[model samples]
Target chain A: MRGVVMYTAGDVRVEERDDPKIVEPTDAIVKLTATCICGSDLWPYRGIEPADHQVMGHEYVGVVEEVGSEVKNVKVGDFVVGSFVISDNTCEICQAGFQSKCVHAEFVAQTIGTQAEKARIPHADGTLVATPGQPEPELIPSLLAASDVLGTGWYAAVAADAGPGKTVAVVGDGAVGLMAVLAAKQLGAERIIAMSRHPERQKLARYYGATDIVEERGEEGVAKIKELTGGLGAHSVVEAVGTQESFMQAVGATRGGGHLGYVGVNYDVKIPGIELFFAGIHTLGGPAPVRRFLPDLIQLIWDRKIDPGKVFDLTLPLEQAPEGYKAMDERRATKVILTF
Target chain B: MRGVVMYTAGDVRVEERDDPKIVEPTDAIVKLTATCICGSDLWPYRGIEPADHQVMGHEYVGVVEEVGSEVKNVKVGDFVVGSFVISDNTCEICQAGFQSKCVHAEFVAQTIGTQAEKARIPHADGTLVATPGQPEPELIPSLLAASDVLGTGWYAAVAADAGPGKTVAVVGDGAVGLMAVLAAKQLGAERIIAMSRHPERQKLARYYGATDIVEERGEEGVAKIKELTGGLGAHSVVEAVGTQESFMQAVGATRGGGHLGYVGVNYDVKIPGIELFFAGIHTLGGPAPVRRFLPDLIQLIWDRKIDPGKVFDLTLPLEQAPEGYKAMDERRATKVILTF
Candidate 1:
């Protein structure tokens, strides 16, 4: 089987690797139908995080090729969408919607990277949600989006309490941020402000339901959000960028008593306690419990109710995984879907 | 008029000061019936916060002596309980139940120290809640408690989402922490764990409805809470002490997807971003919007439903305000109520 692996920073390759197989009774082998590179992958790729011969990719929509004896819900030939953080949804934390912290959870990239011809999924019944059937070829990207980014963006929107009569401010222009605009709109937010400097991303943001765009960054961006929100700030702020500046901007752009749902994987950031306390913002974020929403999101994709797959501006063959990573890392593509 | 003044750190004096007069159309002058030293007061008193001939004291219950032309809800001769933070409830933030950050909000001590013969209260119609009548002499201590500590404790419990079927862990044993146990019980918390080592405070905690008492601190305290919650931390945690250790303990003692309502006046505390991000806790706290809950708290106090005032273990005359501060500073008393 061919799989994507990073031997070191700035070194990504697609090479022949041993095919994944069911090692546990609760595991299943999925024949990868679609997979994609994530913004988070850039962390290790840029040497910001430690990396040594690590298998890459966590987002995927695939067809189950084999199921262990204990697997009851999913069967071979079933099309499914799974979260980046595979969680045994039976844990108390998972039941409470913190599936990312599930007691029996594993990171896909660390165990069986989804960017391969076949991957082993643990806690098969608890982690994988089967779609209605094999989705249309065009719907593949949308289903794959549900595996991570779209679900994460939805979680950010929900955490921010975006809903009818509320104004939502998104703090990043990446796929997640643009998707958050769509989520906020779907949740009935009256106004969606996307803070993006890039014209290309800004166009996509507007297409995804952003009512306003602030080209400024940092304090200026917060000021624009406040100016648009009657100087009170947006009622809900989705922080899609993990940097301290973006987090602070999201916090600053939210009104007092408003919610800040941050999904940006924070890296080397220190949130000022005093500032956050005085800000009077209700904050809930972290690695999203993507599994909790995967079922609904899959249905939405199958029903063609949402086209989050549009985020994938480039597509490549599975053997071209390195190119996929390069495109996303270099900002040449918002997302790159790799066909197996 | 006479008032308590902190001319310098560790130096408190009862001195002659100008009697407060109506300063705004919505202001009222109140003749203080009672006032007390707060834990937060110790900050400035201990020289942690700046103090220079600053009028002290924010907690108070008093009789309205004069009302401005626009004051409609409060009248002269009416007994009232007011929050430490005065706010006009008509503001959007105030209406959202965060009166502490209201556009017209003013800190009581900064504007007109409540520990005085007469003090002017801004936003009289919104900041002051009138009692049924002149509070009986015996109710003064309790009514004064309602002015700050009790309300703050109640806010902590509410913010932590303490209610039926929930286990609540309190991370501070001060007056507010003890009062928080009472609030949790009244809010229908099934189990209340008071983290206290002081024998006297422990007794008071149990008296106020603490079902369990953990004598440990820090990691041990978190372990004890986890043991009590079947290897999971408490569903709700009340952080009444704003220190790095206490804050971390509160965070550690709360289960994933739990609420942490922190009311401690944070000072020089740096919360690690990674810890908070991975903890999966819902956190909300600040200078509590006590005014939002004052009416109900006052009604409960009036009906003798809960005796939060019992926290005042010592009493002193107005002239002995210095002694009250000393007693609290020395931990010789849980709280000291000064009477005129």
Candidate 2:
């Protein structure tokens, strides 16, 4: 089988690799139907993180080709979408809505990359949520979106406590951030602010129900948000960028007693304690427990309640995985979907 | 009127000052029955925080000698206890339960200097909670505790989400920390851990319902908490010390998806971003809006449901204010109460 591999930072290639097999009794072999490059993939691609002969990609919607005897929830020929992090959802932590930190969690595609033709999914019964039926080919991209970005964005909005009567601010214009706007809208936030400088991203943000857009960045961005919120800042803020500046902006953009839901994969950043304390913001975020929201997101997508697939501006064949990585890394595309 | 003033770091004096008078339509003049030195006062006394010719103390229980025409809720001759920060509890922020950040808030001791024979309280109707009736002289100390430390500790416990079936850990052993242990117990936390090295503080903590004591400091303290909680850390953590190390320890000792309520006045501390992001903790803390909880706390104190007055181990006449500050600064007393 052919798979995407990075021998070193900025050195990605599609190479022949061993076909993954059911290694654990709870594992399932997924025949890749669709997958995409996540914004987090840029971490290793930009030399910001360690990457040495590593498999790539963790977002996928696929058909189960084979399943171990212990896998009861899924079976061969079923279409399914699973979270980036595989979790045994029955654990105490998972039941408490922290599936990402489940004791038995394992990162899929770390070695047997999801970008490949086939991959082994551990804890299949708990990790994979099947589509109601065989989803239409047109719905594939949207279902794949629910596999990571949409689910992550929904989690961010929920964590930020965005709901009716809330004025929500989303920091970052990436796919996840834009999707968070959609999620906040779905959650009934009265006002939504999207902080973005990109005109294209801004348009999408508005379409996703952003009530306002702030073109400024950094302190100026926070100032604009405060100005729009009657000088109290937003009641809820979603941080979708992982850098120090964006994190601070998100923190600063929230009013006292507000909530900040952060989803950006933090890199090298130190949040000043005094500033955070003084801000008096309630915060909760991390690698989102996507598995917890997958079922609902899939239903919303299926009912056409949301169109998260619009984030995929470009698409390609599985063989062109490298180009997908390059396009997202260089900011030429919001996201890329690879169809097998 | 005589008030406690800090001429410089480590130098406190009781000196005659101009008597307070009604300065605003919402103001009231109170003859202090008692005022106490706080753990935060030691910050300036130890030179960790700068001190010039600043008036000292923020906690007080007193009799209302005069009320402005606009002060409707509180009347002259009413015995009351007021929060460290005076707030016009009618503001939107105050209505939302964040009275400390009310638009018309003034720090009591800092703005009006509560450690005086007579002090002016702004927004008297909203800032002060009157006791059931004029209290016996002996109840003054406990009522004074309700004004700040006790109410602040109760807020911390509530903010930390401590309750039945939860394990709570306290990361400071000052008067506020000991009081937090009591609050956590009153909130029905199943297991309460107090992290303290001082034997005296530990004894108070145990008496206040600390089920476990961790004498270790820093990383070891966190390790000890983990060891007691089956390696998952506490369900809730109350951080009453504002130092960077204590804040980090509180963060580290809380389980994933746990709550951390911090009440210590932060001075200078930088929190690493990745640690906070990955820890998956719900954090909420600051100068507690004691006004939000004063009515209930005063009721608890009045009913003999809790004895928070034990936190004050030293009492001195108003003329011995300097000695009261020194004793608390040197850790010779958990707290010092000065009588006029």
Error of 1 at B30 (Å): 0.7
lDDT of 1 at A77: 97
Provide the lDDT at A140 for model 1: 89
Q: List the residue pairs that clash in candidate 1.
A: none
Q: DockQ values for all predictions?
A: 0.62, 0.64
Position A134, candidate 1: lDDT = 78
lDDT of 2 by residue, A175-281 (tens): 99999999999999999999998999999999999999999989999999989988888989999988899999999999878899998646578787778877777
What are the per-residue Cα lDDT tens digits for candidate 1 across B88-189?
A: 999888999999888887889786888888888989998999999877787788888988999999989998999999999999999999989999999999
| Stretches of candidate 1 exceeding 4 Å from the true structure | none
lDDT by residue for model 2 (B84-114), tens: 9888999877888888877787787676778
User: For model 1 chain A, where is the 10-residue window of minimal lDDT?
Assistant: A264-273
Candidate 1 is scored at a TM of 0.98
